[model samples]
Target chain A: MVAQIVFIIILLGAVYLFGKNVAKVRRNILLGRDTDRSDRPAERWAIMTKVALGQTKMVKRPIAAVMHFFIYVGFVIINLEVLEIMIDGIFGSHRIFSKPLGSLYGLLIGGFEVLALLVLVSCVVFLARRNILKLKRFSGTEMTAWPKSDANYILTIEILLMTAFLTMNAADYKLQLLHFGHYATAGSFPISGFIAPLLPSGPGALAGIERGCWWFHIIGILAFLNYLPYSKHFHILLAFPNVYYSNLKPKGEFTDMASVTNEVKAMLDPSFVPEPAEVSRFGVKDVTDLTWKNLMEAYTCTECGRCTSVCPANITGKLLSPRKIMMDTRDRLVEVGNNIDKHGKDYTDDKTLLDNYITREELWACTTCNACTEACPVNINPLEIITEMRRYVVMEESQAPASLNNMFGNMENNGAPWKYSQADRLNWAASDKVD
Target chain B: MEQKIPTMAEMAAEGNEPEILFWVGCAGSFDERAQKITRNICKILHHVGISYAVLGTEESCTGDPAKRAGNEFLFQMQAMVNIEVLNGYNIKKIVTGCPHCFNTIRNEYPGLGGTYEVIHHTQLIQGLIDEGKLKAEGGESFKGRKITFHDPCYLGRGNNVYEAPRAALEILDTELVEMKRCKSNGLCCGAGGAQMFKEPEKGNKDINDERMLDVIETGASVIASGCPFCMTMLTDGVKHMEKEQEIKVLDIAEITVRANGL
Candidate 1:
C-alpha cells in the first residue's frame, strides 16, 4: 500500500509536468507566425528519412552520435518493460513479463541492458570529452549551464536505473528459482544464485524483496520522466520532431515578403508611401514575429557551436556570432515568457532585451551565404532571420548599406543598378545582324 | 479597355509567322559593340531563310534589372508597356540577343501576365545548326589559343542553358576550358541585379575580378559569353588586369556568326 501511494504521487507529478510542457509548446506552434512550407509530400518524407530515421544531423560528432542513438533506441524499446514494471508494482501479479513471450521479453530486457551499458560508457566518454580532453572543437561552443554536472547527474541516474534493473532481474530470477524448486535454472543469474544462498531460503522473504526492487525500478523511471522536461535530456524528446520538420527549402528563399505590395510598389513611385500599417515588415522585432519553426529552432539548438565555427564573419574578426544569434533569441524568448508570466499581457520592456542582446552590426554582417546553416547539425536557419532583419533595416527604417542606396537609385532611373542610361541596355546586340 | 499583354505561349505560337520582333534590350540598342552583335545575329537569321522584323524604338525595357533590385513596381510598369507594344503588333516569338531580356520575357513576364516564348540568339542559332538550315565552314583549329565561356547569370543559372553556346564554341575551332565555378555556381559578371549600375560592396575581391581570374586560370585567350553585360564586364576586367592584348571578349552570337562563315 505504501509503495502504491509513492508510485501514484511520482506518476501524477510526471503527468502534470509533461502536460505543462505540451501546453507551452502548443501555444508557441499556434501563435508563432512562421509560414507553413510543408505542403509537399515528397519534402515531408525526405525530412523524415534524413533527419528522424537516419539521425543524419546528430551523428556529425560520432561519439555523442553513437551514445545518443543507443539511448534513443533503448528508451523506445524499454517502454513495454516500463509498463510491465509499473503493472507488477501496482498489483501482486508479476505475470506481465511471464507470459507466452516470457523468453522474448527476457531477451529484449537483456538487449536494453546491453544498450544501456553502451550508453553509460558513451556518456562517460562525452563527459571526459567536455571536462578533461577539452578540445577546441568542444570549447567556446554553446556549452549548456552545468553541462558537465548535468551529464554526470544523468549518467549516474542512468547507471543507477540499469543497476536497479539488473537487481530486480536477479530478485525475480531467485523468486522463479524458489517457485520452481530447482537449483538447475538458478545459474541463469550467477550473481543472484550466490545471493540466493545468502538470503533467507523461504518464499516470503523473496516476495518482499522482489516488491522492494520493483518499487525502486518503477520510482527511478518515474523520476526520470518527471525530470525530462527541464534538463538537456528534453532534446531526447524534442530533437526527433524538430529534425523531422526541418526546412528543406533552398536557403535563399526568405519569408516571402508576407505581402509583396510594399516591395512591389516601392519601385516606380519615387514618392511611394511606405505601407507600415498593411505590410508586415521584415525584422523579427520580438518573439511573436518569429515563426513557430524559428522558435523551435531556438529551442532545438544543441549549442554545438558548429555555426559559430563556420561563420566567416566570426572568423574574419567580426563581432557577429551565429551561435550567439540563436542563444540570444532563446534568452530573449525566455525573458519575454517570464515577463508575460509576471506582468500578464502588458509586458512592454522587451525592447531593452532585444537591443542589448542582438547588435545591428552583427545582424547586418551576414552575407546570406548559408555556410553556417549548412554547417549546423541541428538544421538551424540562422540566415533566414538575418535576411528578415536586413529587410527590416532596408524597408522599415529606410536604412541600407550606403552602397545599396546608389544601386537602388541606378535601378530607379536606368532600369539597371548601373548609372548607365537606358539606351545602353541593348549594347550587346551590336554584334548581331538585323533583318 | 486597357491593353492586354500576350503570354509567352501566345508569342511562341507566332514563330516564323511575323517579322522578327527584334528585342533591342537596353544594352544592345545603346552600346556600340552590343548593337553590332545584335545586327550580326539578325543577319545570320536573315541568311538562314528566317524572315524577321525589328521593333526598334518601339521596344522598351524588360525591367529585369529593376525587378532584381527589389523595385518590382517599375518592373511591372515597364513590362506592362512592353507587353502592350508587342501586342499592338499582334507579334509573337520575340527574339533577343540579350539573355536578361530573354530571361525576363520568358520567365518573369508570366507573373505580370506578359508571358512570351523567348529564346536567346545562341539557342536559335543552335536550332538552325541542328535543322541543317545553317552550316559552319571552319575545320582549322585556332592552335595555341584557348577560349572559355563566362556564364551570365540570366542565361545560365536563371534559364539553365549551358550547352548550346559551348557547342557553338566547339565549331569555332576554339579549345573550351571551363572555369571552376562555371554554370550554376558561376560567379556573376558584376552586372546582374543592377549591380553594374552601382559600386560593388567593399570586399577585397570583385565578383567579376574573381570570375576573370577563373577565366585566366583556364589559359583561355578569349572569353566567350552570351550576354553583353558579361561581355562588357569581363572585357573590362581583362583590360584592367592588363590582359587585354593577350585575351579577347566575344559574344556567343559573334562567334556563331563567324563559325557559320556569315
Candidate 2:
C-alpha cells in the first residue's frame, strides 16, 4: 500500500513537470506571427510521412543513415516497454505480463534486448565520431560548449537508460533462475542473460538492484522528455510537423507581405489617391515578426550540419553557415521567450532578434541557393530564415550593400538592373555582328 | 532567315493573334554575349513555324533581380506594369530564353493577377522536336566533339525542368559528357538570386571558378545551358580560364539552330 502511494506521487510529479515544459514550448512557438498553412491537408500528410516517418532524406548519407536508423527504430520500439513499466510502477507489480503472456513475454523481452544492444552500439559509434574523430560538422565554431555537450548529454542519457533496463532484466532473470517467490521462469533474455550470473545473489540485493533500475529508467525517460524543449534533440518530436509545414511552393517564390503589396498596388494606380495604408515594420524585426512555421523550423533543426555541409556559400568559404543561422534563430527565440515569460506579453526590452544575435554579414552571404533546404534531413528551411532576415535588413533599415543599392537604383530608374534605358533594351538585336 | 519578328502592338495592328509571346528578357535584350543566343532561339522558332511575337520595347524587366535583391517594392512596381501590358495584349503564353524571367512570370505574377503559360526556350525546343515541328539532320554532327551540359539552377532545380534541356541537347548525335555535379546536384554558375547584378562578397573562391573547374575536368568542347545569366557567367568563366578557343559556351537554342542546319 505504501509502495503504491510512493510510486503514484513520483509518477504524478514527473508527469506534471513534463506537461508544464511541453506547454511552455508550445506557447513559445505560438508567440510568432500567424501564417495560414491550412490548405492542402493531403499533401502535408504525405510530406510528413515521407520525410519524417519514412526517413527518406536521411539515407542520403548511407553509413550515418544506417546507424541512425538503428538508433531511431530502437528508440521507438523500446518505448513500448515503457508502457508496461508505467503500469507496473503505478500498481507496484512485478513482471505483470509474465503470467498471461507466457512465451510471448520472452519473445518481446528478447526483441527489446536485441534492440537495446544495437542502440548502445550506435550510441558509442556516434560518440566516437563526435569526440575522437572530431568530425568537422561536430566541432566547428558553431558547435561550442553547450551545443556540443547537449549532444553528448542526450547520448549519455540513452546509454545509461538502456544499461539500467538491461541490468534490471538481468537481475530479474537471475531471480527466476533461483526460483524465488512469485518469480516466474518467463522472460528469455538473449543479450542480458549472460550478465545475470555476475550480479549479487542475495534476495534482498537482487530486489534492490531491480527496483533501483526500474526507478532510474522511468525517471531518466521523464527527464529526457523535458530536456527536449531546450535542446536540438527537440527535432525528435518536431520533425514531423516541421516537414509537414515546409513551403511546398516553388522555391523561387518569395512571400509577399500583404500590407506591402496592398500599398504597392495603390502606388501603381494612375489617378486616385486614398490615405496611405498604415504600414507596419517591413520584413522581420524580431522573433515576433517571423511566422509560426518559421519558429517551428528553428525548433526542428537537428544541428547535424548536413545543410551547412551542402551549402554552396559555406563550401566556397562564405560567412554563411546554414547550421549557424538556425542555431542563432533558436537561441534568439529562447531569449525572447524568456523575456516574455518574465515581463508578460507587451514587454519591451532594448534588445531585438536581428543584430543582437544573427549578423548582417551572415545574412548577406547566402546565395539563396536552396541547397540548405534540400539537404536538411528533417526539412528545416534555414534559407527561409536567412532570406527573411535579409528582407529585414533591406526593407526595414535600407542598409543594403552599395552594389545592391546600385542594382536596385538601376532597376527603379531603367526598369532593369542595368544603367541603360528601357528604350535601348532592343539595341543589342540591331547589332550587325549578331547575325 | 529574314523572319518578320512582329512586336505585340504590330501583331495586334495586323489583327492577328500570336501563338505565344516571346519575352525577350533584359539580359537577352542587352547583354552582348546573351544576344547571340537570343538570335539563335528566334531562328529556331521561325524554322518551326511557331506564330510568336515579341513584346519588344513594351517589355520591362521581370523584376526577378530586384525581388531577389530584397526590394519587394521595386519588384511589385515592375511586375504590375508588365502584367498590365501582357493582360492588355491578352497574351496567353510566354516563352523566354531566361529562367529568371520565366520563374518570376510563372510563379510570382499570379499573386498580382498576371497569369500566363510560361515556357523556357529549352522546353520550347524540346516540345517542337517532340511534336515533329523541328528535326535534327546530323549535318553539324558533334559526334567527334565532346559536349557537356550545365543545368542552370533556376531552370533545373528552381523550376524542375531538368529533362527538357537534356532532351534538347541529346539531339547532338553524341552523348553528353557528365560533369561531376550534374542535374539536381548541379552547382550554380555563381549568378543566381540577384548575385549576377552585383559582385559576391569576399570568399576563398568564387562559385563560378569552382564551377568552371568542374567544366574543365569534363574536357567538353562545348558547354550548353538554357539560361542567359548562366551563359554570361560561364562565358566569363571560360575567358578567366583562358580556354576561350578550346571550349565554347553556347546555349542549347544555338546548338539546336546549328544542329538542324537552320
Candidate 3:
C-alpha cells in the first residue's frame, strides 16, 4: 500500500512537471510572429528530407554523429523498458511482457545497457574534444553555462542507470540459479552471469537483494526523468519535433513584408496612414521578440557548436559566432521568463532588456550566406532572424551600412550603383563584340 | 511570301499586335554586336513568320541590380512603372537577349504586380529550330576544337532553364564540356546582384576569375554563354589571365546565328 501511494504520487508529479515544462516551451514558440516562407513545394521537401531523415548537418562531424545516433536510438527504445520498470515496481511483477516477450524484454534491456555504455564512452570523447583537446572549432565558442558540469552529471546518471539495469539483471540471474539449484540459462546474461558465484547462496538473502536492486532501478529512472528538464539532455526530448518541422524554404527566401496599410489599419490612426504605436519592430532584441519557435530552437540547441565550426565569419576572425547567438538567446529567455514569473508582464522594460542583450554590430556583421543555417544540427534558421533585424534597421530607422547609404543614393539618382549617368548602363555591352 | 527582315527601328515601327514582344534591352539597343544579333533574331523571326514587336527606348532597366543592392523601394517603384507601361500595351509575352532582363521581368517583377511570359533568345531560337522554322547550315563542324558552355546564373539557376542553351550548342556539333559546378550550383561570373556596377568585394580572387579557371580546367577552347553580362565577364577574365588565345567567349545567340549562316 505504501509503494502504491509513493508510485502514484511520483508518477503524477513527473507527468505534471513534464507537461508544464513542455507547455511553457510551446507557449514561448507561439509568441513570435509567423516568419516561415513555405511558398515552394520543392524547398519544403528539401528541408524536410535533409534535416529530418538525412541528418546531414550532424554528419559533418563523424565521431559526434555516431555517438549521438546511439544515444538517440537508445533513449527511444529504453522508454518501454522504463514503463515496464515502473509497472514492476508498483505491482511486484514484470507483467508488461509475458514469457517469450519477457525474454525479448531481457534481450532489449541487455542491448540498451551495452548502448548506454557506448554513449558514456562517446560523451567522454566529446568532453575531451571540447575541453582538453580544445579543438579550434570549439575555441571561444559559446556554450550553455555549466555545460561541462551538466554533461558530466548527465553522463554519470546514464552510467548509473545502466549499472542499475545490470545489477537488477545480475540479482535475477542469481535468483534463477538458486531456484533451479543449477545454471542452465547461464550464458543468457553474460555480463550478469559472473555475479552469481559471487553472490550469497541463500534464497532468503538473494530475494532481499532482488527487491533492493528493483528499488535502485526504479528510483534511478524516476530521478533521471525529474532531472531531464534541467539538463542538456532536454534536447533529447525537444530535437525530434524540432527536426520534423524544420524550415524548408530556399536559402534566400525572405518573409513577406507586412502590407503597410494593413499594418497601419491594425494600429490606432491619427493621420491618413496609421502608424502602429506598438509595432514590435524587426530584429529580436530580447526573448519576447523571438517567436515561440525561436525560443524552442534556443532550448533545443544541444550546445554542439556545429554552427560556429562552419561559420565563414568565425573562420575569418569575425566577432559573430552562430553558437553564441543561440546561447545568448537561451540565456535571455530564461532571464525574461524568471522576471515574468516573479513580477508579471510589466516586470522589466522590453527596450532596456533588448539593448543590453543584443548589440548593433553583432546584427550588422552577418553576411546572410545561409552557412550558419545550413550548419545548425537542430535546423535553427539564424539568418532569417538576422535578416529581419536588418530589414528593421534599414526601413524603420533608416540605419544601414555607410557603403549602402552611398550606393542607395547613387541608385536613387543615377538608377545604378555606379553613380554614372543612366545612359552609361550599356557601356560594357558596347565594348563586347556581339557577333 | 517575301517577308521583310526588320531592323530594331523597323520592328519598333510595325506597331501591330505582335504575337510576341522582343524586349530590346539596354545592351542590344546600344551595343553593336548585340544589335547585330538582334537583327539576326528579327530575320529568323521573319523567316519563321512569327510576328514580334520591339520595345525600343521605351524599355528601361528591370531594376534587378537595384533590388539586389537592398534598394527595395526603388526597385518596386521601377517594377510598378514597367508593369503599368507593359500592361498599357497589353504585352503579355516577351523575349529578350539579356538574361538579367529576362530574369527580372519574369521572376522579380511579378512581386510588384507585373507578370509576363518571358523567354531567353536561346529558348526562342531553340523553339524555332524544333518547329523546323529555322535550319543550321553545315559549318566547319566545330569538331576538333574542344568547347564548353558556362551556365549563366540568371538564365540557368535563377530561372531554371539549363537544357535549352546546351541543346542549341549540341546541334552545332561542338564538344561541350561541363565545369565541376554547373547548373543550379553554377559559380557566379563576378557579376549579377549588381556586383557588375559596384567594386568587387575584398577576396583573394574574383568569382569570375575563379569561374574562368574552372572553364580552362575543362580544356575547352571556346566558352559559350547565353547572358551578355556573363559573356563580357568571362571574356575579360580570359583576357586578364592571358588565356585569350586558348579560349574564346561567345553568346549562344551569336554562335547559333553563325551556325545558321545569318
Candidate 4:
C-alpha cells in the first residue's frame, strides 16, 4: 500500500511538471501578432494528411526516410504500451491487460518487442548520420554547441529507454519461469527472451533487476516529456498543427501589406478624410512584428537542416541558412519572453532580430526563390521572415544597398529602373534591325 | 525600319480602343539584344492582325525590379503612375514578351488599382495557334531541329505558366528535349528577385553559368526562353561558354516569327 501511494504521487508530479512546461511554450508562441489562417479547411486537411500523417515529404530521401519511418511508426505504436504502464503504475497492478485480453496480450507484447528493436536500430543510424557523417548542413555555425548536444542527448535517452524496456521484459519472463508469486506466465518476449539468459538466475535477483528497469524506463519517459518543450523534439507534437495551418495560397503570391493597401486606399479616394490611424510600421523589426504563424513555424522546426541543405545561398557559400533564420527568430523570441516574464509587460531588450541575430549580409544573400519554403517538410517559411526584415531595412530605415538605391532613384525619377527616359521607350521599334 | 507602332496616346486621340496594350518593359525598350525580341513580338502581333498599341513614350518600367529589390514605396509610386496612364487610355487586355512585366501587371498591379487581363507573348502566340490564326510554316529555318524551351521563372514557377510556352514550341517542326531541370524545377537564369541589377555575391560559380551547363547538356542548338531578362543572361552565358556561334538563344516570340516566316 505504501509503494502504491509512492508510485501514484511520483506519476502525478511528473504529469503536472510536463503540463506546466507545455503551457510555458504555448505562452511564448502567443507573444507574436495575430494572423488569420482559418480560411481554408479542406486544403489544410489534405496537407496535414500528406505531410504529417502520411509522411509524404519524408520519403524524398529514401534510406533515411525508411529508418525514420520505422522509429516514427514504432514510437507511436509503443505509446499504447506506455498507457498500459501508466495504468499499472496508478493501480499497483502487474500485467493487468493480460488477464482481460487473454492471448492477444502476448501478441501485442511480441509486436512491441520487435518495434522496440527497430526503434533502437534507427536511433543508432540517426546518431551515426549526425556524429559520423558530419553532414555539411548539420555542421555549420548555427548547429555548433547546444543544438548538436541536444540532438545527441535525445537520441541517447531514446536508446536507453528502449534498452531498459527490453531488459525489464526479459527479467520478468525469467522470474515467471521460476514460478515466482504474482509473476504471470504471459507476454511472449520474442526479442527480449534473448536477454533472459544474460540476467542473473535467482528470483530475488530477477525481481530486483525487473523492477529497476521498469522504474528507470518510466522515470526516463516522464523526464523526456518535460524535456521536449525545451528541445527541437517539440516538433513531434507541433508538426500536425503547423502543417494544418499552412498558407494555402499559391506559392507564387506575395501577400500585400495591410498598411500599404490602406495607404493606397486613401490615395485612390479623394472624398473622405481617413482617420489618423497609428502610423503603421512597414515590416517586422522583431518577433512581436511577425505573425503568430511565423512564430509557430519557428517553433515547429525539427532542425533537420533540410532547408539549409537545399538553400542556394548556403550551398553557394553565402551566410544565409534558412534553418538558422528560423533559429534566430526563435532565440530572440525566447529572450523577449523571458524579459517580459521577469519584468512585467514594460520590459525591453537592447537587441532586435535584425542585426543582433541575423545580419544584413545574410538578408541580402537570399534570392527569394521559395526553395527553402518548398523544401521544408513541415512547411516553414523562412523567406517570409527574411523578406520582412528586408522591408524594415528599406522602408523604416531607408537603408538599402547602393545599386538598389540607384535602381530605386531611377524608378522614382523616370518610371523605370534605368536612367533612359520613357520618351525613348519606343526607340527600339524605330532603330535599325541588326539582322 | 520604322514600323509606325501606334502609341496609346495616338490611338486614344483617334477615338480608337485597341484590343491589347503592349507593355514594352525596360529591357524590351532600351536593351540592344532584347530589342529584337520586342520586334519579333510586334511582328507576330501585326501578322495575326490583333490591334495592339504600345505605351511608347507613355510606357515606363513596371516597377518590378524596385518591388523585388525591397523598395515598396518606389514600387508603389511607379505603379500608380503607370496605372493612371493605362486607366486614362481605358486600356485592357495587355500582352508583353517579358515574363517579369506579365507577372507584375497580372499579379501585383491589382492591389494598386491597376487591373487588366494580362497575357504573356508565349500564351498569346499559343492562343493564336489554337485559334488557327497564326500557322507555323515549316522549313523557314528551324525545321527538323532539336529546340529546347527555357522556362522563365516568373512565367513557369512564379505564375504557373509551364504549358503555354511548351505548346507554342510544339507548333514548330523542331524536336523538343528537356534539360535535367526544366519546367517547374527550371533553374533560374540568375536574374529573378532583382538579382539581374546587381552582381552575385562571391561563390564558386554563377547561377547563369550553372544553368547554362543544363542548357548545353541538352544538345539543343537553339535555346528558347520567354523572358527578355532570361535572354540577356543566357545569351551572356552562351557567350561566356564560347558557344555563341553554335547555340543560339532566341526568345519564344522570335521562334514563332521564324517558324511562321512572319
Clash list (residue pairs), candidate 2: none
* Model 1 chain A: worst 10 consecutive residues (lDDT sum): A181-190
Displacement of the residue A1 alpha carbon in candidate 3, Å: 5.6
**Model 4: per-residue Cα lDDT at residue A70:** 87
> Tens digit of lDDT per residue, candidate 1, span A367-403?
4435577667657777666655555555556665566
Candidate 3 docking class: incorrect
Deviation (Å) of B184 in candidate 1: 12
- Superposed on all Cα atoms, the candidates' RMSDs to the truth, in angstroms, are 8.3, 2.1, 6.7, 3.0
- Name the regions of candidate 4 deviating beyond 4 angstroms: A175-179, A193-197, A264-272, B1-6, B10-16, B49-51, B88-92, B125-150, B170-177, B181-185, B216-222
* For model 4 chain A, the run of ten residues with the poorest summed lDDT: A249-258
Question: Fnat of each prediction?
Answer: 0.10, 0.52, 0.03, 0.48
Worst 10 residues of 1 chain B by lDDT: B1-10
The reply for model 2, stretches above 4 Å from the true place, is A197-204, A270-279, B217-219
State model 4's lDDT.
0.84
The share of true interface contacts that also appear in candidate 2 amounts to 0.52
DockQ-wise, the better of 2 and 4 is 2
lDDT tens digits, residue span A79-131, model 2: 88998888887887777887788889889999999999999999999999999
- What lDDT tens digits, residue by residue, belong to model 4 across residues B84-118? 88999997799987988898888888977899999
Q: Tens-digit lDDT track for model 1 on B47-93? A: 77665666654566676654544444455667767777777666668
Q: Residue A41 error for model 3, in Å?
A: 11
Q: How accurate locally is residue B139 in candidate 2, as Cα lDDT from 0 to 100?
A: 45
